[model samples]
Target: MGAEEVLTVISNVGIWRLLKAVGRSRQRLGLDAQRRRLVRSIVAHEERRRVDSEAHP
Candidate 1:
């Protein structure tokens, strides 16, 4: 899933519960990898946008 999907799931389920589940599952959920995926997706998305927009404001 992409970052938006991950964020939607987290928002629906609650971050604390997700954290507890991750903790109890010995991290087999690969949350870190998912996080890395999210970060990369966000960076890639941002890179595709117009960088000049930020400079004018």
Candidate 2:
């Protein structure tokens, strides 16, 4: 695979669960705020990429 396929596998495995694990671990380590911002940024960037790809294709 491709990047998209890899991302698809990640999503299929449950993105929320993965994010929650990251968030929880970060919170435990005292990085709650930064973790939340990171997750939001990642989500926003992914959304934009998806939209752009769909629009162009």
Q: Estimated TM-score per prediction?
A: 0.41, 0.48
Clashing residue pairs, candidate 2? none
- Candidate 1 has its poorest 10 consecutive residues by lDDT at 48-57
RMSD of each: 12.0, 13.8
Q: Write the per-residue lDDT of candidate 1 for residues 1-57, one digit (tens) a residue.
A: 999999998797797687777686656557677889999999988876757567665
Q: What lDDT score goes with residue 42 in model 1?
A: 96
Off by over 4 Å in 1: 1-29, 51-57
In order, the Cα lDDT scores of the candidates are 0.79, 0.86
Q: Which stretches of candidate 2 lie over 4 Å from their true place?
A: 1-30
| Candidate number with greatest lDDT | 2
